[model samples]
Structures are given as structure tokens and as C-alpha cells.
Target chain A: MITITGLQKRFGKLAVLRGIDLNIAPGKVTAIVGPNGSGKTTLIKTLLGLVRPDSGTISLAGVSLNGDPSYREMIGYMPQAGKFPENLTVSEVLRLVKDVRRHSGPLDEALFEQFQLAESLNKPIRTLSGGTRQKLSATIAFLFRPEILILDEPTAGLDPVASAQLKDKICRERDGGRTVILTSHIMSEIEALSDILVFLQDGKVFYNGTLAAMIHSSGETRLERAIARLMEGGDAA
Target chain B: MNTTTVRIIKFEFSDVLRSKWVLIYGLFFFLLTETLFRFGGTSARVMLSLSNVVLIIVPLICIVYGTIYLYNAREFMELMLAQPLRRRSLFGGLYSGLVIPLNLSFLVGVGLPFLLHGVERTAHLQAFSMLLLAGVFLTLIFIALAFLISTAYEDKMKGLGIAILSWLLFSVAYDGVMLSLIYRFSDYPLEKAVIALTLLNPVDLARTLLLMQLDIAALMGYTGAVFELFFGSIMGAAISLAALSLWVICPMWLGLRQFRRKDF
Candidate 1:
């Protein structure tokens, strides 16, 4: 489990996160959903230590997020619109990450094989299509079998078949008892995969609970309508 | 320094090798040096001509290339940031990756021609070594400046523009300004002042060191005498080198501080 308290962050004069307090449970999928500029990405990046918060305490599995970076070993992060060194071939890039990892159990090639990544292994990253790059991102995120997976807009550019395959992978990972956190605009993807919905608004948490509860409490059957109601200032907490 | 940093450097170096730009850069130097040796008469005279060329070229190329490379690698840096990597390690890796390959290309590109031309005399070899040493220092100093500009500016063109402007300030404009100052204040006891001022511009520091070694301060006229009188000593030479190294370190340290705090 990951615990966060009084988390606050500001970029210059603009505050992106405001006193966020939450617990992200393990063995479940949590989807942070919000409109653009609603602090979803900032909160995620703070957890990843990509952004430093103004005030906060974040502990992963009871270990504080201090300057020491070893805790990140258990987390896998897939950036939104992942970009890589253009000239490096796919396999070389993989090798670089593996070398940086410096430790390995039996390799998790399940997603790698499922994505048919071997066929594209020799091609440089610049040559890969958007979907191919997305597939590669997903492959790497799951490759280490990390305890927590943080994926940003994972299904944005994927084809329907690839999207379904990724959704299946997310479910299987969650079933196998790893914590998964993701942010997406697609309500159906949220409804289908996530166990808990953390709705963000104006840099604050508007609602945090299950999708079914959000839908039922907001008097809307659809996740999209429920979120829309929340955005329109309907309190469903 | 750590294993992760080493791995990053290793991959980055291999990737740079495959790009072929460094090879081309080395080739350019080899051709330039060879052509100069062919046309520029005696070896000593050729070294002097090469010194002038090195003063203008090294800073220009290192600053511009380093800036563009850093800007281009921003996405790659972002990718690395999300990994289980320290910013310090990442910075070290990125820095050494470029610095090592670039310095090697420079050494081999410029060194091969002189070796082939048989600069075997010890004095000639020592002077050649000083020239090469100066080039390396200028490269180190300017690349650090480039890193500062690259990290400080978000826009590519702004970073690039500042990079070119800095090269111009150091290489071309600085001399014009200094010469004018010396002429305007020619009446004053300005030898010490000139020495102090020259130390401020890394290019001038490097040039003065080379000229002092060549014992050809006459080419610089009055101000050159001031330089020869002061920086002509062994201690002065060491001081100039230390200043040049500071030029390299200060900017890199500043750039690293910014990089550590910068948001992706």
C-alpha cells in the first residue's frame, strides 16, 4: 500500500496539487480520473518522484519517500506519449533498461510475447508506429513484474485489439495481487478495469470510492455521466 | 560513478558511435589538419595557424553541438527520469557520455595528422601537446557553458541562440572589446590590468598560454608584451589553466543544480 498525507505542489504561481490525502491499496487497480489540468498527472508524478511537492509525506509499503531512491525499484512507470532516443533499436533500448535495473528474477516476457515485440526488436524507435510504441511502453512497464504499476493514458493510441489485450493484462496483474494506478479519459476503460475511482477537481479530490458506488450515488448508470455530474458540482461523496 | 550511471554512459556512448556524426566530426578535423600541414609551410608555423583555427572552432562546435544534443535528448532524459535512477547519476552519465566521446574524437582527429607529419622533436611535441591541451580545455569549458544554457532555457531556439551568442562573445567579440580597451587606456600602467582582463575570457587565457609557449607575444603587440611579462612565467601558466578549468566547472555545477530541480 501507498499512503500520502497533506501533499501539496505548486509550479511557480500555479498550484497543481492542494493538500491531497489518500491511501492507494495494494492488490487492486486505482484509476485517477479528472479533466485536463486537474492535477491527476502532477499527483502521479509526485509519487514517481519526478516532481517534488511543496509539503507532503508519501510512504510506499511503510517506507518514506525520502531522497533515497531504492523504493522506486518496486514501481513500474509508463509515461504518457513515451518518447525514446530515436536512433536506438528496440532491443538496444530494452538492454539499456535491463542493464540499469542491474537485478533480475526470471524475466517476465508474457506481455513481450503477447505484443509480438520480437518482430520489431531490430527497428529503431523512430521507425515504430504510435501503437507499436504504446505496446512497447506497456511491455516494459510489465516486464519487471514490479509491485506497483503506474501507467499514464495507457490506451490512448492503441488499436481496439491491442487495447483489449492491454486491458486483459491489467486485470491479470491485478488478480495476481499487484497494485496498478492509471489515469485515463476513457470512462469505459475506467469502468472495466479500475476497482477504485479517485475523482480529482481543481487540484482537490472530489470523490474517492468504487465505480459502482460513484455511479449509484450520483444517480447515473454510466461512468461518463457520473463523472460529468461530479464535474458539474454534484456532490456524490 | 554508480553502476546505473555507468550503464547509462555505456548505452549512450554506443548510441553515439552508431550515429556517425562523431566520425564525421573527427574526419573534418583530420582533413583540416592535413590540408593545413600541406599548405601552411613549416610545422611550427602550421601549429600557430592551427592554434588560431582551434581558438575559433573548438568553442563554436562544442557549445553548439552540446546545446543541440542536450535539447534533442530532453525526451530521452524524461524517459530516464521515471526510472529508478538518481538525478545526480543521470547528470553524470549524460555529461560523461558526451564529454568522453567528443574528447576522443578531437584527440584522434587532430593528433593523427601531426603524428603522420612526424612532429618527433621533443620541443615541437611539447608545443603540440600544449596546443592540444588548450583545445581540450576550450572544449571542456564551452560544453559546460552549453549545458548551462541548455538546461536554463526551455525553447530550443533560445538555447541555441544563447549558445551561438556566447561563442561569439568569447571568440570574436571579446578580442575587439579588449583591443579597444587597451588602446583607449594605452597611457595608463595597464599591463597588470590587461593580464587580469585576459584571464576573464577563457579563449584569451588559452591563447595567451599558447602564445607564451610559442614565445611569439610580438604578434599581439603591446598587450601581448603585458601577457608575456606576467603570464610568461610557469606559475602564470598554471593559474590560467586553473581559471580555464573553473570556467568548465562553474557552469556545469550551475547547470546540474538547475537540472536537479527542473520539472519534466
Candidate 2:
């Protein structure tokens, strides 16, 4: 339920997102994969209104998001590192988010319980381990049951159990007809979770299609090999 | 003034209050004031001595603390930006969050000592109030200046360097340049020029305000007489207060503009 046209972003002389035109439909997981410095984060940041595009328009369900922050309420974003105020406790961070969102619905304590964060409620964020921090980030992202989820490397530091729990949560969200946009380096996670794949190269979309279509076109059965071949093939022509 | 703004301010203020550095800052002031009182024979002498100390230390603390806090709060700011909150509220919250606790700390640390020492009974009460007022103004002015510098650059070291340099320029170097200008233009009519120059630097403006109210024109020489003529009256005091307020507003406005347009 998002549309971006002619989106270009440049950091000084380096063009990060060059002429991007993308559409993300609802009720599906759209996995964005790319090599390092391929503007995946920049593209996501632009959609979140964190990075102002040099030239382009991003509309959410046909309404322009320029200078309007209210649209962000529909988006639940989990940043890559999940850096929080060091002094605030886990529960405090959650409470702060809940306060900001003003969500009146019954709180989703599933991820909170799954991650076993209840015991660590009083522990400061600085004291939490990296995996616990990721759990906290994951819990907050799904806490509001938002219409859309934008997760940047959501499982980067998550342990195996937490990661599986998160993967299941993503699938459940997709089944519930919620849109999810995620970026991850793990090929298997993308293959298992995403319905549509958008591969980026050098600040431009190199390939966009279903996993089956990408494999068929690349003449490779495996998703990773297909992506590698697609990178070598160029333009997906 | 929305709930989000209030929440942010509450969160930030409590977070900063819990920091040991802020406690150390308050204790530092408490100890310094107590020491000044013990050493200086008369209450008037103590107020004058504390003015110099306040002039130098308050701006330094505000600049250093403000820059460090802004840089440290980068992640928290990013988190808030992703929320459904307005940019104005976020910024307003963060600014007030920093300013309120700092103002309270100064009031408690320094004001308590003056009240306890019974400086209110003496003629130095006006000077004491002036000292506290100037301290508050300088704290705000330097904090705004720090925010401006922090927002302008991406590099933390560079931002901090510029902030410290700015504090140096206003507190120490500005006075040196002003003196040199006065000496060089001794033959020219520089009363109005000197007054204008003094207003440009918040530190100098504060010192001039306090010194004028102290009525020590003979000790201050030519610039003192000019200041007395202009700042001796209520109108001049109002003008100086306005000028100092401008120093706080102009930089903060510019910084907030930059903050709004900034890409996190």
C-alpha cells in the first residue's frame, strides 16, 4: 500500500537511491535484498521520512507524505541497531512507546513473553545483552499490531529461538493480511518469509519478481544461486 | 504542549537527572559557592568573585553538557522521529528537557547558598540577583549555541570542537578583541560602538549588566561610564535583557530549523 516514483537520494557526490520507482502491495512480505552500500537502508529511510529524497514523491495509499507525520502512525519501524536511551529500563522503553502511540487496544504480550522480557523489565537498556535488545525491538515492532511493519535486519542479533519466534510472527502477520517490508542479508530467511523479492544493485532495482520467477529466469533452483546469477546477468532482461 | 511533547520532556528530564554528571554538576556548584563564601570577607566581595566564576563556568558547562547530550541522544531522537509525533513537539520537548533541569540545578546549587548566607539583607542583593539572572541567560544562550553547532555537523568531535571554540570566542577572546578595538580607536568616539560590541557577546553583556548595577563606574573606566548612561536606567536594563533573550532565541530558532530539515 505504498508507491514511490522517481525517488533519488544523493549523499554529497555519491548517489544512494537513483531514480527508484517501487510499489509495495498489502498482505504480503516484500523482502529487499542487495549487496553492501546498495541503498537498501536509504530506500527504507526515505519511505519512513527519515531521509528526504533529493527528487521524488512517496505516497501512502495515494496520499503524499511530505511534511505530514501522521502517516507514520500506520508504520511500525524497527531500526537496524535498535539503539535506545541507555538509562531507561526495558519496561520503561515499552511504556514510552505505548505512551507515544496511545494505543488503547489490549497490549500484545506474546513477543514480550516469548522473549522472556518480563523478568528483565526493571533492567536498564544498557545492561541488556545484544540479543535481548533485538528481542525488545521485535516486541515493540509488533506490539501495536500496526498495519505495516518496516523491520531493518530485525533478526541480526536475535538468538535461534527468538529468531524463529520472530519468523513465525512475520508469517502470522502476513497471514493476517498485514504488510511487511524487511531487509536482511540472510538468504534463507528471505526465501522462507518474503512473497515478493526486490533485489537492488548500485542504487537501482536490478530484479523484482516472485521467488519462483526469479529462479526460473536465472536457470537456478536455489534462491541464493539465482540471486548471484541474477547479479552477474544484469538488468533481468 | 501535547502529550507526546510532555512525555518526551518527562522522559528526557528524568533520564538526565539520573545521570551522575548532572549530580556532579550540581555538587560542583554547591561546593564552589560554599568555598567562595568561606574565602571572601564581605558578601559584596563574594558576589563579585562569584560573578566572574559564574561567567566562565556556566557557559562552559552548558556548552559542553549540551553538545554531549545532543550527540548522545541521537538514537533516542531517531526513535522518536519514527513515531507519529510532530517534529516541532519532538524538538521542543528535547530543548525544554535539557533546559529545565539545568535551570533548576543552578537555582538550587547557587541560590540556596546566597539565601542561607543572608546576602539578601545587604546592598549586594541586586548584584546577587543579577548574577543569577545572567547565569541563567548565559546557560540558555550557550546551550542554544551548542545545539546549533551540533546540528550543523555530522562529526561528533568536530561538533564538540566548534562548540568549545564558540565558548572560548564569546567568553575569553571576545573580550580581548573588544579591548584591542577600544585601544586602537582611542581617538575616535567609541561609546556607542563599545556598547554595540558588548551586546554581541552574551558573556560581556552579562558582565556589563552586573558591573553597571554594582555602580562601580570608576573601576570600569570609559566603557563603564557609557554603560552607566545606557544601562543605569530601566529602559537600558530592558534593552540589555531583550538583547540577551535574542541571543537565546536566534540560535535556537536556527538550530531547530536545521533539525527539522535534517535526515536522520
Candidate 3:
């Protein structure tokens, strides 16, 4: 479990994360959804230690993440898959990440095989198509058997088949006792996969609970309408 | 973790090497050194000419290339930052990867011409080594300055412009300013004051060091004779080297501090 307390971050005059407090449970899929500029990505970046919070403390399993990077070992992060060392071949990039993580086991190449990345392993990342690069990102995220997975727009460039496969993979990982935190605008994706709903608005947690509870509170039958109701409530307040 | 640092260094080096910019940089130096040796006659003359080139070209290329490369690799750096790597390890690896390859290309490009031109005499060899040392020091200093600039600005055009402008400030504008200062203050006993000012500009210090090695301290052309008179040659050379080292360490230290707290 990851716990964050009073996290705050500002970019120049605009505050991105204003005193966010949250607890992410293990063995569950938590989908963070919000409107544009609602601090969803900022919250995830703080948890990933990408953005340094001005006033906050983050603890993973009771140990503080302050000034320590080794804690990231258990966390597998897949950003938008847009950036790779452009000169490196796909396989070389994979090896570099593997070397960085230094995870030892039988190795988790399940997604690698599923994606059929062998054909383009020798090509430099700059030469790969957008969807191919997306596939590579997904493969690497699952490569090390990380206890926690942070995927930012995991299916952004994926094809229909790849998207279905990835959703199944997320479910499998969640059921296998891994903590998965994802941010996506597709409410149906969250409705199908997530156990926890974290709705952020204006850098604060507007609502944090199960989707059932969220729907019940909003008096809406559907996930999209329920979130809309909550957003209206937030705007009114 | 040490192994991880090594891996990053290895990755960055290979990626940069494949780009072949270093090879082109090497070729430029090789041609310049060869042409200088052919016309300048003696090893002493060639070394002196090359020192001038080093004083101008080394810092310009190092700073420009370093800044451009840093801006291009910013995204890749974010990828690494998300990994389980410490900021220092990533930095150490990148610094080594960039500084080492650039220095090697420089050494080979210039060293070959010097060797082929038969720099076999003891004095010539010593001065040649000193020239190489100056190049290495300038490389370290300028690359660190590049990192400092690149980390401070997020826009590529802004960072590149500032980097080139900084090179101009250090290499060209600085000398112009110093010359006017001397004319304006020629009445004062400015020996110690001029020496102190030289310490502030790394390019002048490097040139002074090279001039002393060439046994033509008078060629400094700016009353650098008094700088020589301020201290013995050996002591003076050591002091200049230490100052260049400070040039490397100070900006690098500040840059690393900025990098640690960087948003990306």
C-alpha cells in the first residue's frame, strides 16, 4: 500500500497539486479520472517521484520515499511511450531498462511474446511505428514483475486487439495481488477493470471510494453520468 | 548500482557514437592539425597555432554540442528518471559518456598529426602534452557549463542561444572587455589586478598557460609578461590548471543541484 499526505506542487503561479492526501490499497486496480488540469497526472507523477511535492510525505509499506530512489524498484512505470533513447534498438532499450531495474527471476516475457516484438527488436526506437512503440512500453512495464504498476494512458496508441490484451493483462495482474494505478478518460475501461475510483478536481480529491459507492452517492446509474454529477457538484462548491 | 551507472554510460556512449557527430568532430580536428603542422614548420610553431584554435574552437563546440545533445535527450532522461536509478548515477553516467568520447576524438584527431609530424624532442613532447591537457580541461569546463545552462532553461532554442551567447561572452567579448579595461586603467599598478581578472575568464587562463609552455610568454600580447612575473612558470601553470578545474567543478556542482530538483 502507498500512502500520501498533504502533497502540494506548484508550477510558477499555477498550483498543480494542492494538498492531496490519498491511500492506494494493494491487490486492486485504482483508476484516477478527472477533467483536464484536474491534477490527476500530477498526483500520479508525485507518487512516481517525478514531481517533487513542496510539502508532503509519501510512504510505501511504512517507509518514507523522501530522498531515496531505491523504493522505485518495486514500481513499474509506463509513461506515454513517446520517449526512448532514439538511437538504441528496441531490444537494446529493453536491456537497458532491465539492467537499471536489475530484477532477477525466470523473467516475465509474457507480454513480450504476446506482442510479438521479435520482428522489430533490431530496429531503433525512432524507426518504430507509434503502435509498435506502445506495445514495447507495455511489454517493459510487465517485464520485471513489479509489485506496483503505474501506466499513464496505457492504451493510447494501441490497436483494438492490443488494447483488449492489455486490459486482460491488467485484470490478471490485479487478481494476482499487484497494485495497479492507471489514469484514463475512458469511463467504461475504469468501470470494467477498476476496484477503486479516485476522482480528482482542482488538485484535491473530489471523491475517493469504490465505483459502487461513487455511483450511489451521485444518484446516477452509469459511470459517465455519475462522474459528471460529481464534477458539477465540485464546480458548484 | 555501480553496474547500473556503467550500463547507462555504455548505452549513452553507444547511442552517441552511432550518430557519427563525434567522428565528424574528430575529422575536423585532424584536418586542422595536419594543415597547421604542414605550414607552421616546427612542432613549436604548430603547437602554438593549435593552442589558439583550442582556445576558441574547443569551448564553442563542447558547449554547443553538449547543450543540443542534452535537449534532445531530455525525454530519454525522463524515461531513466522513472526507473529505479538515482539521480547521481544517471548524471555520472551521462557526464562520463559525453566527456570521454569528446576527449578521445580530440586526442586522436590532434595527437595523430603531432606524432606524424615527429614531435620526438623532449621539449616538444612536453609542450604537446600540455596542449592536450589544456584541451581536456577546456572540454570538461565547457561541458559542465553546457549542462548548467541546459538544466536551467526548458526551451531548446532558449538554451542553445544562451549557450552560444555564453561562449561568445567567455571567448570574444571577455577579451574585448579586458583590453578596454587595460586601456582605461593603464595608469594603475595593474599586475596583480590583471592576474586576478584572468582567473575569472577560463579562456584567458588557458591561453596564458599555453603561452608559457611555448616559451613565448611575450606572445600573450596583453602584458601577460607581468602575469609570468607574478609567479614562477611551474607554479603559474599549476595555478592556472587548478583554476580550470574550478571552472569544471563549480558549474557542474551547481548544475547537479538544479538537476536533482528539476521537475522532469
Candidate 4:
């Protein structure tokens, strides 16, 4: 389980995450839905320790993740636009990751077979399409079966079938007693995938709970309308 | 954990070894050294001045090697940090890895030839030891500087620009400043002025040390005693080596600290 409390981050007077708090349970998919520049990526990066929090503490399983980077081993991260070395072949990049982790074999082959990455393993990353690169990233993120999976805009370049295939993989990881925190601007994807919905606006958690509760509280059936209502000040505005 | 550091260093070295850029740089350096050696026969004294030339070139290799090393290993560094390794281990590993292969190549390209046909056995051994020491000091200093610059700039071009500018300031520009100071202080005791200048510049200090070891101090006139005081006695050598080691370590510690606090 990942527990974040009073997480505050800023970039030269531009506050990104301001006094944000959230609890992510194990065996559940938590999707953070927010507008553009709403600190979705910042929050995820901070959680992964890529960005430092100015004034808050992030605890994973009762230990503070402030300085102890070893906690990251239990976490797997996929950036919004995942960047890898353009010169590296797909298989070479994965091998580097696996070698670092010393988990070279015993990878779950479901995505490997499903995405048909076997054929293109020798291709340089620069030659791969955006969708194919995303597939490679998704497979690597799930390769280790990390206790915490943080994916940012995972399906942005994915085809409809590939998107569906990835969602199925995420669901399986969650079902296998892992916590997945995914961020996407797509309302339909969040509604389909998220058990817990975190609505963020201007770097603060405006609302947090189940997707059904988010829909019902705003008196709206759709998740997007609920997010819009919550961002417009949660009935106070 | 130390082994993990070694592993990281080994991986970085191997990856860099396979890079076309690294290969190109290595070949360029080898050719540069050979050209200098082949064309540098103005006098026996000039041929003997290879030690000072090597001192200057050592840091250049370190700068180029280190700047490219960190830049190319961006993804790998991130991956390593995400693993269970400590900051010190990774750093130590990288430091040793870059130093070993680079110094070994320098020995092969420069040291062997100088030893084989050019110098006496004892002189060759002293020259080799001096080059190794110079390599260590230069590698440590430049790698730390490169790491600090790499961490400071998110843009690759900006970081490279900063690194090259830094190298210039320490190398040619620094020599210019020392020359100007000597000219300006021509009335003063020249030896004191030289000592002050060498103390101020690590590269010059290294050059002076190597020159003194090669017994070419007479070329610089009466100002040679300034270096002799620092390189003549065992105690003096120990003190100079200690100072060089400090130069190696302090910047690295600062760079590592900055990296630890860095958001990226």
C-alpha cells in the first residue's frame, strides 16, 4: 500500500502539488483524473521519487520514501511519453533493465506474446512507431510484477485493441495483490479501469473515492461530468 | 553492494566501449598523441617535454570521457538509481571504470613507446608513475565537474557547452592568466610568483610536477626551484599527491551531494 500525506511540491512559486493527501490500497486500480497542468504527472513523478516534494512525506508500507530510494525497487514507472535511448534495440533496452534488476528470466510472457514484441525485438527504438514504443514500455513496466505500478497516459498512442489488451494486463496485476496508479485524461478509460477515483485540479485533491460515488455525488452518470463538477469547486462554487 | 557498484561501472564502461562516439574519440586521441610525438622533434629537450604535454592532455581526455560518459548513461543512471544500490557504490564504480580503461589506453598509446626506445629504465618507470598519478587526479576532477554540470543542466547541449567552457578556463585560458601574472610581476621575486600561480592552478601544478619528474626544470630558467621544493623530497611528493587527491575527492563529494538532492 502507498500512503501519501500533505504532499507539497513547487517550481519557483508555481505550486504543483499543494497539501495533497491520498491513500492507495493494495489490489486496486487508482486512476487520477485531472485537467491539463493539474499536477497529474508531477504527483506521479514525486511518488516515484523522480521529483522531490518540498514539504510533504510519502510513505510506502510505513516507511518514508523521502531519501530511501531503495523503495523504488518495489515500484515500476512508465512516463507519459516514455523516453529511451534511440540507439538501443528493443531487446537490448529490456535486457539492460532486467540485468540491473537481476531478473533476467521468468518474465510473464502474456504481454510478450500478446503485443507480438518478439518479432521487433531487434529493432532500434527510433524505428518503432509511437504505439509500438508504448507497448514496449507497458511490457517492461509489468515485467517485474512490481507491488506498485505508476503509469502516466499509458494508452495515448495505443490502438483500440492494444489499449484493451493493456487494461486487461493491469487488471490482472491488481488482481494479483498489486496496487496500480494510472493517470489519463480519457474519462471513459478511467471509468472502466479505476476502482478508486482521485480528482485533481490545480495540484490539490479535490475529490477522492469510488467511481460510482464520484458519479452519484455530482448527480451525473458520466465520470467526466463528475470530474468537471468536482473541479468547479465541488458544489461550493 | 560494492560488487553492485563494480557491476554498474562495468556496465557503463562496456556500453561506452561499444559506442561509435567513444570509439571515434579514442581513435582521435590516439592519433592526436601520435602526431604530437612524431612531429614534436624540434630538439631532444622538446621530445623530453612529452611529460608536460601528457599532463595537459590527461584532463582533456577526462573531460571528454566523463562528459560523454554521463550524457550517454542518462537512462542507465536512472535505472541504477532505481535499483537497491547506494549512491557511493555507483559513483565509486563509475569513477574506477572510466579511469581504468582510459588510463590503460593512454599507457598503450603513449607510455609504452616512450619506455621502449626513448628513455632510460628508471626514467621511464618514473614517467609512467607520474602519468598514472596525473591520470587519476585528472579523471577524478573532470568526472566530478562533468557530473556537476550534467546535474545542473537538463538540456544536453547546455551541459556540454558548460563543460567545454570549464575545460577551456582550466586549460589554455588559465595558462594565459599565469603568463600575464608573470609579466605583470616581473619586478617581484619570480620564483614566488611561479609558486603562487602553480598553487592556484591544479593543471599547472600537475604539469610542473611531471616536468620536474622528467628533469626538464632547466628549460624554465631559475624558476625551477619553485617546483623542486614541491616535487624534490619524498615529503614534498607526498604533500603534492595529498593535495591532488583532495582535488579528486572534494568536487566529487559535492557533485554526489547535489545529485542526491536533485529532482531528476
Q: Which candidate ranks first by lDDT, i.e. highest?
A: 3
A-chain TM-score of every model: 0.97, 0.96, 0.97, 0.95
Instruction: Report every candidate's CA lDDT.
Output: 0.87, 0.87, 0.88, 0.74
lDDT of 1 by residue, A82-158 (tens): 78888888998788777776657887888789889999999999999999999888888888889999999999999
**Candidate 2 residue-wise lDDT at B196:** 90
DockQ of all models, two decimals each: 0.68, 0.77, 0.81, 0.50
Sort all candidates by DockQ, best to worst: 3, 2, 1, 4
Instruction: Write the number of the candidate with greater DockQ, choosing between 1 and 4.
Output: 1
Model 3 ranges off by over 4 Å? none
Estimate the overall C-alpha local distance difference test score of candidate 4.
0.74
Alpha carbon lDDT of residue A120, candidate 3? 92
User: What is the per-residue lDDT of model 3 for residues A173-196, given as tens digits with 9 covering 90 to 100?
Assistant: 999999999999888899999999
Runs of candidate 1 with Cα error greater than 4 angstroms are A234-237, B221-223
DockQ of 1: 0.68
TM-score of 3: 0.98
The residue-by-residue lDDT of candidate 1 on B28-130, one tens digit each, is 8888889988997567888888888888988888899889989989878877887788988999998888888888888898999998888856777877998
Q: For model 3, how does the per-residue alpha-carbon lDDT over B16-35 read when each residue is reduced to its tens digit?
A: 79889988888889999999
- How many clashes in each structure? 0, 0, 0, 0
Q: Cα RMSD (Å) per model?
A: 1.9, 1.9, 1.3, 2.9
Per-residue C-alpha lDDT of model 4 across residues B9-100, encoded as one tens digit per residue: 67666766766444564465456555655777432343455555665676776776677767776765665665555666666777677766
Native-referenced DockQ of model 2:
0.77
Residue-wise lDDT of candidate 2 within A1-237, one digit each (tens)?
999889999998999999998899889999999888999999999988888889998999778987878888888898898889887898889888888888877877789999899999999999999999888888888888888999999999998999999999999999999999999999999999999999999899888888778888888788999888877766465
Candidate 2 residue spans exceeding 4 A from truth: A235-237, B120-123
